[model samples]
Target chain A: MSDTFNFFEYYTHISQEDILLSYKGPLTDVLLSEFSRDIRAKLQEDRRTGKKVFAIFMEMAQNVLYYSKEINHFGNNDKVGTLVILNTETHYKIVTGNLVFKSSIPLLIEKCEIVNSLDRDALREYKRKLRSAPSEHESKGAGIGLVQAALTSDNPLEVKIKELQGDYAFFVLGVSVEK
Target chain B: MENLEIQGESGVYFIPTVKLRADTGVCEISGESYLEDTSEFYNAITNWLEQYIREIKKPLTFNFRLTYFNTSSSRSILDVLRVLKKFQEQGGKLTVNWYYPEDDESIAEEAEDYMKDTGLAINMFSFEPEE
Candidate 1:
């Protein structure tokens, strides 16, 4: 049996939400800067919160760009991911999802839990300590991006990990900035 | 020695504007820094600072007016600060001024963190963005 995808139904569902922008494709530095410009424009109404939202967006998008398991045969052979921004009356939400190795899920969840459990001062101290340590190039920023995202949003990370076929899993990270 | 100057670009990736002068002894790095090659980008600047301290030994001033920088850039920044701290330790005159948007406390706080990390005195200056 085959399940046919319905574009119209998906569009209807998306339009019903408060999504400001959404994209599912290769996460390249070029595309990241383009999305950065778009996010800056969309968040122009509030300058202060816009900075926080923009900072969080960069961190989360770059996370997908670096760690996603799915590689796209596009410019620079970049990774693929999904990014969405939603606007609410009081906050702006940034969400990113990408495929990763299922083996990394437990570590990712542990990292999120540690970040969520920290207070503002603790998070700052953690980031400082990480920054001082020598980073391995393979770690791709050494998880400081996640800590930076938490610090900028001043909110706990909303993470969801779903096991996929074979050794792959989908990792979704969401952060909110009060406007 | 020849000076180093790079025009920062914000296209595919952000490159912080850099101007390191051996003649005037005034170096300035302004604009956002979220480069694809963070280490390669900042290493050249750090090397230049080291050379200036070795050869010039004059009163050097560094002005940082970055509005945004990522975590990797933050590490590179600490490297730069370390260089300044070294110069200060060796009896070389140095002044490091960090300028940020008057409304952005995070940038100011980041400079403060650099100060704490490097044990270098970084003067903080906040400026208003023209509307």
Candidate 2:
């Protein structure tokens, strides 16, 4: 519940997976630039392999920028969150953690369930349907962004919710794009 | 009037390339778009498109070949599509073509979503990276 929890503690728990690059900072354009450079390098190493790693990375990074609750003075006015990328022997995993009010959990869970239940083709059709629907409450439930993330990812989307203090929850989403 | 073009850079946000031809009303928006100020970056394009619809009133052709764009940019893209929809309703001839990497199904889906959202007909094309 306390905002004083050391971020270093969280960093220590990252799995032993090979990290081509690790960045912890205010999510700003500057940080994104640096992060993109590192990711581009790693992606280039496998560029000839026909992997769409950068597109997946861009989605994860945007989620962190828009959903993270921890704010610093340096970054853009987007939301605050922590984002990490792990490169295993055969795939790349992108993890992002952000805070959302407890009230929104049900809606979030429903959206995820609906997205997960569909195959790639169905998901694409659903995404198109949502996109075409009139803007409800100013584009909050469009769900197009998350659907796009799922379609880009080869593995099923993984979502974990951890209860924080009174009305806040930390939501962690993991997506894997195969090489 | 004149074609609009913007270059891409690092750290400064993705500047989408815009090519609008007054003679033919053909506009193409390509490249990556993740701007620090989404409204500021896209305002001009939206306004230009609006003016073209009001003044030029020619058959409009739009081509989208963007590889990456953030959620905020997505909103602006919707705005562009909405304008085209309005123009079409007013008896303006409009055609939209969306190009995506063959492997990037997400982009293709995004284009489809826009078409569905606006009820506009769009031709979708897939391009594979050259070997």
Candidate 3:
């Protein structure tokens, strides 16, 4: 089978969703800032929703930045991931996808389940516990970013994991922020 | 050590304004911080705080008025806060205040979360945004 992804098909779907922006490739601090500023510019009317959308965007964006299996060997060496933001009549959707090692999938799924299961107060408590706990010296994060993303999102975590060739899998997370 | 002052810059990535004054023991990190290198930029600030606390031996006040910061930068912020909290536990006079626009509760929630983590009182200040 051809390994080509159909850009036309993907963009057609994007256009239908009224996506404000969609990007595929490496996610750097610079690119993240650009997306952030764009979100602010587009959603200037609602400061609260803008902030929440931005917050959720940042957290989810970082997950792609840190966890993606495919590395960007170019400017600002880092992993590459796909990121998309949609503006609908009632809500904003921020979606990010990246390749991850197969070994990490179970943990990611478990974390998502827990976040999806909790209420706002329990989520806050979970965040507190994670934040206060002593961290391993080399731990990427306490996964507080995910917690913050879930809290900022309008709905529970929406995740899809697909197995890729070898020891890698594609992970996509979609978060919604209602206006 | 002499005071450290860095003019904040905004672009694809923002560097927050950093001013550390040893004489009056006042340090302020304001504006936005989403850096090309989070650790390299923040280590200088944390190192200065460490030195000042050890040698200067004066009351320190930190005023943070950051409008935006990315999650990676937030880690460095927590590192700085942890240093301050440690100093406070060791009988160092320390005061931390975080300022945000009254309209944005996102920053406020983040500040409160920082306080919750460090077990330190972070005074909140609200201000009007310029048109």
Best by TM-score: 1
Clashing pairs in 1: none
Order by DockQ, highest first: 1, 3, 2
- iRMSD (Å) of candidate 2? 3.7
Q: What TM-score do all the candidates reach, one by one?
A: 0.95, 0.78, 0.86
Please give the lDDT score at residue B7 for candidate 2: 63
- Please write out the lDDT profile of model 2 over residues B1-131, one tens digit for every residue: 66566666545567778787878788898878878777777888888888888889999999998877865687778888888889999999999999987766667878877876788998999987442
Better of 1 and 3 by lDDT: 1
iRMSD, all candidates? 1.0, 3.7, 2.5
TM-score ranking from best candidate downward: 1, 3, 2
lDDT of 3 by residue, A1-179 (tens): 57698989976897885788899987777788888889888888988788788878877887787778889888667889999898889898999999988998898899889988999878877876766655545355637778778877747889999998899999999999887
> What are the runs in model 2 whose C-alpha is more than 4 Å off?
A1-17, A48-51, A73-80, A132-142, A165-167, B1-3, B127-131
lDDT per residue for candidate 2 within A1-179, as digits (tens), equals: 79998888777765454765566656765677677767777677566322455656666677666556667655345556777787888878787788877888898789888989999878877866665556556343346667767877746779999998888999888877777
| TM-scores, chain B, all models | 0.96, 0.91, 0.96
Better of 1 and 3 by DockQ: 1
- Chain A TM-score values for every predicted structure, listed in order: 0.93, 0.79, 0.89
Worst 10 residues of 2 chain A by lDDT: A47-56
Off by over 4 Å in 3: A1-12, A71-78, A132-139
- Interface RMSD (one decimal) of model 3: 2.5
